[model samples]
Target: MRIDLTSVFVDDQAKALDFYTDVLGFEKKNDVPVGDARWLTVVSPEAPEGPELLLEPSGHPAVGPYKEALVADGIPAAAFSVDDVHAEYERLRAHGVRFTQPPIDAGSVTTAVLDDTCGNLIQIMRVA
Candidate 1:
């Protein structure tokens, strides 16, 4: 099966939407309410608009643990491929993005990590 979607847990959906759209430049794909929360998704301009990142809630018990563990470890953010890591990094920084890790050579790929200002870090990467 093709990898059409991935998820990033957020404390709030509305806040996450602003960051993803306003800061990251990802267009909103859909916002479907599924019970107490919503099934929010966004897609990059480069992508076919089919694959989107599911912005799920961290309030649920099942995902709360997983989300906390990842955030606590200070691991890299959800990796997103960019045409030019350096350029993209600069663009984001100019937009007042707070970066925890600057763009650096990662052997095969150059990557950078930044806080989404919501709850989790976000990663931007490019092929080396």
Candidate 2:
């Protein structure tokens, strides 16, 4: 079997949508109202029919602590593949994206980490 979808817990769905779409350049795939939250998802514009990243609401009590711990430890919640890590880093930085870690060559790949502003750290990487 193949992967279908993955998720990133977000503090605010609206802000997450703006960042993931307007900033990160992902395209909205689904947005269905589910009680107090929405079943929102985004997909890479380059791969519209591929795996979708769910912009999950962090309403559950456990999510806050989990996200905090991850951030405290400098761990990324999700990683996105890019054509050039350094280029993407510069572009994002120009758009006011605050990166926790600058792009660094990690043997076979280069990566950088940025705060998503919705309470998560996201990584962008490229094969070196």
Candidate 3:
């Protein structure tokens, strides 16, 4: 009935942690050690009790190919809502974020895609 947590496969957990928190501004929620990988999760600062994003490791056999295919096709692994797509894009760009696609209107919304640098493309969008 409701979403609690979601995940995106990451090539490296440490780098993803820095980017998701230091750059994108998400707050760290959990960091439990799970064998070789940690059960790391982050939550939006605006809604600390909202759904959490799990930065899962891409060590599984199928994950590498799946991520590669998605990137090759210019697809975003996750989409985050923003107040202003263009403004967010600009702000992120200034912080050295590399966007695969700049903000563009698409019918009812505007979106921009940026590489997460940990092997995933993420999209920031605003409803128009």
- Each prediction's TM-score against the native? 0.87, 0.98, 0.98
Worst 10 residues of 1 by lDDT: 62-71
- Candidate 2: global Cα-lDDT? 0.96
lDDT by residue (1-128, candidate 2, tens digit) is 99889999999999999999999999999999999999999999898999999999998999999999999999999999999999999999999999999999989999999999999999999986
Runs of candidate 1 exceeding 4 Å displacement: 62-65
Which candidate ranks first by lDDT, i.e. highest? 3
TM-score, model 2 to reference:
0.98
For model 2 the local lDDT of residue 12 reads 95
After TM-score superposition, the amount by which residue 124's alpha carbon in candidate 2 deviates from its true location, in angstroms, is 0.6
Q: For model 3, which pairs clash?
A: none
CA deviation > 4 Å runs, candidate 2: none
Which is superior by lDDT, 2 or 3? 3
Candidate 2 Cα deviation (angstroms), residue 111: 0.5
* C-alpha lDDT values of all predictions: 0.85, 0.96, 0.97
